[model samples]
Target: MSSSNSQKEILTLIRDVSTEKSQGERRVVNLKRQIEELQSELESVNAELEDAKRLKECTEQDLKGCEVELAMNESSIQTLEGRIALLQGEVSTIGSDLEALKVSEDICFVAGGFRFMCMLIKCLCFEIAWTCWFINLCEHAFRMKNGLCDDFIGKMFDLNAMIRKFHQSVDSASYEAFSSKAVLQNVHTENAHTKQVEEGKKDLERELAQIISDTEKMEHEFLLEQNLHKQVRSSP
Candidate 1:
């Protein structure tokens, strides 16, 4: 009986050992599966971290570029401001010159008009003289054929020479008138050019102001991005 009891106890021990070994095997397999899942998750997390690091580098590069652009804009804005000041000085100078030109133009206009009027009167006198000479010559020819007097021909030639001299004097006066008109036109052209230059300068100043505003805004955004990158880097 005792032998039988001992054999039964041994058998019970063997069965318990077998069950415990089976449970241990199952637990080990479950732990291995958990480890594989964890490993896969770790690999996924590492890939995401690498991508984030690359993104951070790109963002930093963009911030650096923004700073460079901001610096350049500041320099350009300063240059444009100086240029605007120069243009303003030029505009003031041109205004004074324009006033002087206006006075000169007015004076020249009256003188040119008088000279042209005199020239016209001289031309009329020449025309009248020519007509008289032609009529006198025709009459002299007829008188010669009819055997009459021809004493008026010499006098008519002398009168025509006097008219030619008067015409030449008037032509010389008209040259002065033409020169005055050309000078007045040149002054007007210069005034117009100066005004145009002033307008262009104003446009450039406005454009530079806009660029400055945009560059400052971009700089602000760059600072914000830098801060965000710092926060992200320190988060973990």
Candidate 2:
């Protein structure tokens, strides 16, 4: 009886040991599966971090490029502004010069017209003096031919005076005509200069307009780039 009891106790102890060993093996397998899952998650997180770092570097490069472009645009804007100011000043100067030219042209026209009128009057006076001299000479010749007893010496003196008067009238007429011509030429010169100044003003205006257009385009591009940079900075 004592031997049988001891064998039974030993068998019970062996069964308990076997059951504990099986439970321990199952727990170890579960822990190994958890470790593999955690390792996979760590590798995925590391890849995402590398991608984020590369993206940050690219974003920094883009920001630097944008800054450079913005600075260039600003410089261009300043240059255009200066050009616009210079053009405006030139236009104002041209306008003033044009006004002066117009006034001068008007004065020249008035003077030329007056000179032409004076020339016409002087020519008419010359014709009248010549007609009077011819009539007097013809009368004297008729009297002499018919022996009318006219004072021949006095008649000769009168004819000489008339001839001298006719010569003076002719001189005056020629001088008036010459003066009129010179004044007309001056008027033409002034008109041509005015036309040239106007053409220059127009060219300046066109250049100013083109510069303004270019500035507007650059400003728009700058705004777009600035907004893109802001978005990039705000991104996660």
Candidate 3:
């Protein structure tokens, strides 16, 4: 009677141990499935993160290109402005020289007096030579004022056109810079970074860790029950 009771007790303990082991295995399987699901979600988030990074790179490139173009346009505009100033200075100098030549021509005519008359009467050839030389000087000064002055005006027109072109380029570059800034701002505003996704991933990781811990605890409990079953069977 005692042996039969002992055998019954051993059998009951073994059954209980097996049942717990089976339940623990099931829990482990479920935990593994949960982990796989979490990993899949993480992969999807990572893909989205990669796309956002690529878009940011492209926007940065565009912004840098626009900035370089703006710098070049600004430098060109400054150079044109300097050239215009130099040209204006040259024109002013030319005007002053023309004015002085005119004053000299007038003074030559004002030198008419009895002494001049006597000299002309005494030396007609000499007076004629002096008069012709003076006329030639006046004519040369007039040619320089007319011909070269027209050339300067033409150059000034060319400079003005260049200045206009520079201004147009600056305007275009400014527009491009503005457009690029808008694009960059939009990109940032869209918030295509990984902050939110990282939070989700962290949540999944914690859940997976908890599941694994619970599964391990279950396994430990199952092992303890198995040991208890063996001890019962070996009892005297």
> Model 1's lDDT to the true fold?
0.68
- Each model's TM-score, in the order given? 0.48, 0.48, 0.33
Residues 23-133 of candidate 3: C-alpha lDDT, one tens digit per residue: 999999999999999999999999999999999999899878766765665565555556545655555564555455343422222222222444435455644665676
RMSD of each: 17.6, 22.5, 39.5
Model 1 ranges off by over 4 Å: 105-174, 177-236
- Write one digit per residue (lDDT tens) for candidate 1, span 1-236: 99999999999999999999999999999999999999999999999999999999998998787667656655655565565556556555655554565445454455566657778986888788788868877776776754344455666678768877887888777876667666655665566434534444455455555655655565565556556545544653
Segments in model 3 whose C-alpha atoms lie over 4 Å from true places: 90-236
The CA lDDT of each predicted structure is 0.68, 0.67, 0.57
lDDT of 3 at 94: 49
Q: What is the RMSD of candidate 1?
A: 17.6
Better of 1 and 3 by lDDT: 1
User: Among all windows of ten consecutive residues in candidate 2, which has the lowest summed lDDT?
Assistant: 105-114
lDDT tens digits, residue span 130-234, model 2: 678768877877767545446665766787797678667666755754564455555565664445445544655666566566656655665665666566557
Q: What TM-score would candidate 3 get against the native? A: 0.33
- Give the least accurate 10-residue stretch of model 1, judged by summed lDDT: 192-201
The prediction achieving the highest lDDT against the true structure is 1
- Evaluate residue 197 in candidate 1 and report its C-alpha lDDT on the 0 to 100 scale: 40
